[model samples]
Target: MNKKVVVVTGAGGVLCSTLAQAFAKEGHLVAVLDLNQEAAVNVANAIVGAGGTAMGVMANVLEKDSLEAARKTIHSTFGPCDILVNGAGGNHPLGTTSKPYLEPQDLNSTVDGFKSFFDLDSAGIQFTFNLNFIGTLLPTQVFARDMVNREGCSILNISSMNAFTPLTKIPAYSGAKAAVSNFTQWLAVHFSKVGIRVNALAPGFFLTEQNRALLTEPDGSLTQRGQTIIDQTPMGKFGSPEDLVSTTLWLSGEGASFITGIVVPVDGGFSAFSGV
Candidate 1:
């Protein structure tokens, strides 16, 4: 495979950092972008230390100006991006309900921290939407220009299993990811004439820093919610960040040249199980 210029947003996080390293290992020039400058620098430095070509860039996916600045830096350092991965997204506590179902008495209860669907914060919901959907959009706008009409270039989005089915608590995240899936299809069609392939990876139940507290106890044991996921997943385990690497590479590489507008699940059969 020819060495390509690959840019991965959210590289400071667990999944995207793994992705950045994997791309670099494959002999691609990588730009590790994140809102957190320190985290981005750390991941990029690690890749460079491992004998890969990489540079860290600070970028806020939500802000067009920040994304444009990062794009300029990446273009100057790595040439035009041949592959782009939009991975900056997560759930917000404020957008999540404390419980799955709404109950009659719960609505009238005076519990201090009780949050139902009705109690979901509008600001939190907006934040989730902006972070996931708008974040993906702005970055794509700023960087995809380099990919337009460029042969063998592609855009890979980080969607979630929540896009297929709404999770119990995180309605906002679920909806935002759904929009991402929809946008992926739309972009695939819109950019087809420009030679840009668009696709997404819908990951399931991965143990990352973002969800570690909700899934595992401090003692390294599974939490109740984690146990529920395990019971539901056919694999009976949470996925590691590395599980996504192979599929990610395939989707962004020549192997899947004909593929576009699809959201492939790397879910360990979690989406396939029906509790039978």
Candidate 2:
């Protein structure tokens, strides 16, 4: 590697921060990008203190103008981008149903606890889609221009386990992530000759801050839902932030040059085993 400039969106998130740190350690000029300006700057400062070249940029993935500004700043400072990590994505509660399956008795009953598919707010659904789908698309539009006609350039999109198979309750997220996987393949084919490698990472069941409430109870124990998930997982444990490093590093490096348009699941056999 010739110290290529690498940009990681959502650098404030746990998974993305780790990837940013890994790139920093490898001596690449890192651009830590996030919706939160201060958080992104903090990650960049941490990298700088550890003897790496880095710049912090604030960007809203859904907004084209803001992303364009971010690209200009990074281009001027670190030259063109060689690696792009599309890590800025998440789900919304409004887009989620309270139960996995709808019950007829629950429809007319005004229960404070249950929400049906009809209760899904359109704004939340649109927001989730814009965040995960359009969010991934626009960032690529802004940053990938630098990768065009260049050698050793790649883009990594973050997909979820639900992408391969939809999970319960989060229909919007599942659909959006599925689109991400499909888009990864579509973009890979479109940009093959332009020298940009497009791929995705489907991470499964990490109890990050984003989904901690859904996975665990307030008393610091696994909730019923969490237990069910653990039982289903062949590994019988949740993944740690470090668990994904190997796959991420390999996909970002020259070792994966021939690989593109594939979604590599970093799950503990979650996508492979069907409990039989």
The most accurate candidate by TM-score is 1
lDDT by residue (tens digit), candidate 2, 1-276 = 579899999998888888898899988999999999999999999989999889999999999999999988998899888999999999999899988998887678687856799888999999999999999999999899989999999999999999989999999999999999999999999999998999899998998898999889999899888998888888989998788778888888899999999999988888887867
Model 1 lDDT, residue 238, Cα: 88
Tens digits of per-residue lDDT for model 1 on 1-276?
699999999999999999999999999999999999999999999999999999999999998999888988888877999999999999889999888788898788688877888888999999999999999999899889998888999999999999999989999999999999999999999999999999999999999989999999999999999999999999988899999999999999999999999999999999999889
Shift in Å, residue 209, candidate 1: 1.1
In candidate 1, what residue range of length 10 has the lowest lDDT sum? 105-114
User: Number of clashes in model 2?
Assistant: 0
Question: What's the count of clashing pairs in each model shown?
Answer: 0, 0
**Candidate 2, poorest ten consecutive residues by summed lDDT:** 106-115
Question: What TM-score against the true fold does each predicted structure earn?
Answer: 0.98, 0.97
Name the runs in model 2 displaced over 4 angstroms: none
